[model samples]
Target: MLELNFATSMNDAMSDTMIKENPFSSQPTTSAFTEESTYQAVCKSAVASAIFAVLGLSAFLAQMFMLLPILGIVFALLALKAIRAYPDELVGKGAAKFGLLLSAVCLIGSGAMHSFIYATEVPEGYRRISFAELKPSSRGTDAQGFPKRAAELDGEKVFIKGYVRPPSGKQYGLKSFIMVGDFGDCCFGGDPAITDVVAIKIQSDDTVNYGYGLRRIGGTFRLNPSTAASDEEEIPRVFYEIEADHVR
Candidate 1:
């Protein structure tokens, strides 16, 4: 009878041990190791940092769209929080910090660049000229005439009105040039094409879906005429074109 009692006691002890060892026991699984939480935090930080870095860069390039950096900074702060909470993920933490630093640098650089660009006065040689004053039928009456006019009006800041014409193919669809003169079948008996057009070279992010119509661009007049045939496609000859401080 004593042997039987001993055996029963031993069995009860073993059962209790087994229950404690089981993962499904009452004890919380996450109570022991925090590796899972650390991994999650690291992932979050890395993603946030990458996002901020991209946004900050975008804002810096497009002076008009300056709000991108502000949002980037906000995201960077979130990334910093995640990194601080999970120091075990040192790589992620470092990335987040770097992103924040980059954002700050880009923001400051963008502001400085914008101030410098806008504050600089138009050179006396690059003043604005009125398109109405240009005589299309005169002796200098060629595609190059407008550009010469631009050079003459260099310091005389003026506003020019024109329409945006879409390019031919799908690949060139995004490229639209500003036409200073009329846009019917022909302008002054010349073919109505973008050949003599002033290419606006808008940034990729700028909206280009505005319908073809009269739009005014105001900026310091600058002449960028190209004599080389190969360089013709890249830069237009007559740049009565505005460096566009404002487009209305």
Candidate 2:
């Protein structure tokens, strides 16, 4: 009878030991070692998520890096998964979610901005010209000012990119405005030279928001006779104007 009792006590102790050591057991006796490993993974994930957030925000600096925001979002998602898998041992779930949110925002905002800038594809067959293409010389009506190539573009449907002078009111969809090579030269402070300016007349009811930026304008090009005065000198101003159809 004593031997039987000793054997039973030994079996009970062994069963308890097995239960404590079994990691998958319903009643787990978790150790500091397992928790430490999980915490380390959580830390790594959190740091990765933070890195993603920074990259996503800075992605706007270069058009080629537009995919960075998506990459950041992916990293944040992986971090969240790590946190979820070791909920009892790991932390930073909140951080991971916040990182994901920031990444998504950056991605969407960057996409919208790109669309705004590039949506207007310069229509095919439209002649492209620049202020320098006018070949403006020191004086108006100089042969150099109206090059042969520029004269050929006159009366043709052409596209030009430049800044517009803001009207008196912050108007949208202006019917007419002065187009200039440099905003500071015409509207802000300095007197605008004739060759540096073009008068734009819009035919379509396209509402152009008055602001400062390089905007593409499409219209029928013309050489109009316009003049300006400085110190009682009838300074020759811009001889170019456009019957604008589109301004964006």
Q: Best lDDT goes to which candidate? A: 2
Q: In lDDT terms, how accurate is model 2?
A: 0.70
TM-score of 2: 0.45
Model 1 stretches astray by more than 4 angstroms: 22-50, 78-96, 119-121, 128-165, 169-248
Give the TM-score (vs. native) of candidate 1: 0.43
* Candidate 1 lowest-lDDT run of ten: 227-236
Per-residue lDDT for 209-241 in model 1, tens only?
444445555555545554222223433344344
lDDT of 1: 0.54
Error of 1 at 45 (Å): 8.2
Q: Estimate each model's TM-score.
A: 0.43, 0.45
Model 2 per-residue lDDT tens digits across residues 1-248: 99999999999999999887877867534466576665543546666776777778765643456677777777778878877787766678777787788888888887888777555556776777888777554434435446565567778998887877665554576777777777575357556666666778788877666675666898898875343322212233456778888777
